[model samples]
Target: MPEKVKTDLGFADLQCRKSDVGRISRIAKAAYSFNRRFFGKEIKKPFHIIICYSRKEFDDIWGAETDAWLTGFATKTGTIVSFRDDLIRKYNPRKEATLAGTLRHEINHIFYFQIYGSYEPAWLLEGLTLQPPFEPFTLMENDKKRLKGPLPHLIYSTNGKTFFKQAPFLYSMAFLATRH
Candidate 1:
């Protein structure tokens, strides 16, 4: 249903249904703008997106490779898969918001690599990056939705050991720590 667009870059490619172009473009632009605002300048990077009709289609697109190597990767070395998408027909009608979150999250990884030479600790990267005060989510309808909350069980460390055990809870706690 969607047409394929190949850029001169030869690396990035996208396929989308005829109706989704405007929506997808707007999502990408907003993500780009958000990144530009917090980080001092805009970055022009090659991003390839496939508009999937279903979650199966998304999975297929995700598994496709550049040559033979997998085109995807997880943010963590031990975590084999980098990104995952769930197509919620009803709950996920907000594609633009979804796209915005995905782009911002992944792009933050690249930004950190540029600065620190590699992804820092999960707590540091995810902790600070999750800072909504820095770049808030696009789904907010009012001040309440835009509101920031506390992270409940966060534990910080100069060394990585303590933080990785209960990363999720720790990150949540860390986020709360920043608020208070």
Candidate 2:
């Protein structure tokens, strides 16, 4: 179970094991700060946040079958951010930073949906969502072969079903295109 943390923007909650409270709190604070600066007002409804301590916990809660590589996602109601505790312990030193960025990114999705409604074009919606400073390029960082073509064509062909797989490339391209 998690405890409620009061914030000016909206309803905030944290769910993690006792060992993770401090780190998760810091991420939450940063996210709230970003929301305050970007949106300039409290969101019309409460925003709930859940920090899963491990990928297993995340999969169990969401009924997902795979080891989660995507990190986080958001819907109208809330955002779920996951940290791979085992991987963090053994491999990634920047896990917390990644967690913070993912939270910001996912929360932005919720914020944009609330303000614009869900009917916005995918390119515009994703571009606006990526407005916050984070490494959108990191998704395709290692895929040199995939980076060779006309990006817009690839982006235009993607639909909701394929969006998740193509999001990293599409999001970066959309962000670059829309930011100007």
Candidate 3:
């Protein structure tokens, strides 16, 4: 059970430590703005943002084993939970991961869910989540022979247990597929 924290923002209800509340609120606000700009529309729904400070906290909230590579998640349009970037950086030391990007990616999920009611073809969902400054596109990264191999089917079709087997390639390929 997590304690709820009050936030004076209209876009989201934030729950985190006193030290992180402001930063998370700011990032969330900025991410929502980016989403609004990307979608070229305005959304007024209030969402929840939970900042988890440890792997145990995140796993407890998730009620299962989450991928070690992921830093955050948008459980649905109404809520998102993220691990502290600094605490999780060890998992993505070379991946250029950041707290801002995680929030942006997760919030995009909420924005799209509001629009399409449900985002399908996990590739599109995953792809759309990787907007500029959030998860930049790269042709390929080193040690990614999985990309050279036959690309996995759409991201959703792949079982969640193995969804991140080749995440780097999946994200890159998804970005390419969704890029206009």
Candidate 4:
């Protein structure tokens, strides 16, 4: 198949493996609608969403600072980089409950960046992304263990590289902080 199939999803211009077009499109649409209503702002310009079919592809795009465990992430310029849900499901059962919200979480980061600008604290950015109206926010056993450690590592992270380097631990705490 072609490396990627391109399509316009109204709010986003997507590029993905031919097989991911349908599934990614659905998630992107839901993410767009959720962000629009939750943030009370619409992405006026069409942003980009790139879905990688495998870990090598994702790592190639991510390059330096690539975290082995991240399912998806957003850039400051309004882009979402991710694996399709099937790929995520096979490798990371821990993230299963939040699989459908991966795009939404990335979209949430985009909205957060758009509204707050860059340099906002990573905890706030991550915490808010895991907040309600997007996904049901479930925690697995691994998540529970992270809560036992000192939080400075999770709370002090100020960039994606640092936050995602410890994403497995940080994301769970981030969600817990925002669950109210």
Instruction: Compare the candidates by TM-score and give the number of the best one.
Output: 3
lDDT of 4 by residue, 43-154 (tens): 6656899877778877777776455566777777777887776777655565554446787788888887777776366667778876676666678776776666665354
Instruction: List runs of model 1 lying over 4 Å from the truth.
Output: 1-15, 60-97, 134-174, 177-180
Cα-based lDDT for every prediction: 0.45, 0.60, 0.74, 0.72
Report the C-alpha lDDT of model 1 over 42-151, residue by residue, as the tens digit: 44444454545544454564444222212222232211122223342223333333445665555555555554655555556655555785445332233223234442
| TM-score for candidate 4, residues paired by index | 0.83
- Higher-ranked by lDDT: 2 or 4: 4
Is candidate 2 or 3 superior in lDDT? 3
Q: Report model 1's TM-score to 2 decimal places.
A: 0.51
lDDT of 2 by residue, 1-180 (tens): 454343332356666666676777777778767865787866666666766665676667666654334556675555555553454433342344366666676667777777777725666766665664643434345343445665444355444557667755676677666777
Ranking by TM-score: 3, 4, 2, 1
As for TM-score, the candidate ahead, 1 or 2, is 2
TM-score for each of the candidates: 0.51, 0.70, 0.83, 0.83
Candidate 4 Cα misplacement greater than 4 A, ranges: 93-99, 149-156
lDDT of 3 at 132: 61
Count of backbone clashes, every candidate in sequence? 11, 0, 0, 0
lDDT order, best first, reads: 3, 4, 2, 1
Task: Return the clash pairs for model 2, or none.
Answer: none
Off by over 4 Å in 3: 1-4, 139-143, 158-169
**Highest lDDT, which number?**
3
Please report the TM-score between candidate 2 and the true structure.
Answer: 0.70
